[model samples]
Target: FNDGRIQQLAPPEDLYERPENGFVAQFIGENNTLEGTVETIGEGNCTVRLGDGSVIDALPVNVSRAGERTLLSIRPERAEFNLDRLPEGTHTVKAEVLEFIYMGDIFRVRLRIAGNENFVIKCRNAVGQRRLRPGEVIDVGWLPQDCRALEAA
Candidate 1:
């Protein structure tokens, strides 16, 4: 959508980073969504005005055709874990600890968001550290810059 070119091809790092549609974003696992409106477009990036009145600077995507409202998708790994308190200029979400399993090298924690979306985080298990129990409340945070705002199909 950025350059008005739609052909089946594998673009280089510069081109790939700025996909042509939401299809590329889904393939890249950018799932978390936010509502925003396009403000400006640049060579490799664009500025989006979110519904919450927060301006989001993201990689240039092909959502130019999308009118006033647009959905921004983000990946889970790009999110950060905030234990003490929520960080500023970041997206915060509450999740229930479903399971904490020891997988030898790391501890896999399964978290469910809003009783639907599920995400797993891997943490190094200390030799003598206490394990994280299930049914615990964990605070998760993700930087807006880390999120990918792609066009939805």
Candidate 2:
């Protein structure tokens, strides 16, 4: 917390995969977390309605009900940018390329999604796409298993 009155303890993967609260989720890594409402829950999955009315499928962690508030966190490395074409029903969303931080192979893709300006999706420049321009809308997404739904703080 910015107040610095809190602390959490967890192993690496659990800290990253199943954050206990919004604070932990944001603190652990480079992540894009959005507040959402749970729409449904199943055996090992759940559907969350995001801010822009984009219903996203995610792996349930801290939420388990139809009307519960949850914070969804997705790491940049888990997302794919501008795939030639994705199969039907993939968890894709439209995001504008905000900025590109060039690394030798892996580059950071900052994006604006659903009017939120703090999203990012990192990719390998060695792959097909090497350039991304600011303000260019592109399709970006990750597997459902890679998206985590955590308890809203």
Q: Least lDDT summed over 10 consecutive residues: which range in candidate 1?
A: 12-21
User: Which pairs clash (backbone N, Cα, C closer than 3 Å) in model 1?
Assistant: none
**Candidate 2 weakest ten by summed lDDT:** 82-91
Candidate 1 residue lDDT tens string, 1-153: 325655335655423344445555545433455567767766655667765465666654555633445556555445446433335655465667888888898776777754444566666666654566788876665554555556644
RMSD of each: 6.2, 2.7
Model 2 Cα shift for residue 45 (angstroms): 0.7
Stretches > 4 Å off in candidate 1: 1-22, 26-72, 83-87, 126-131
The Cα local distance difference test for each model comes to: 0.58, 0.81
TM-score of 1: 0.52
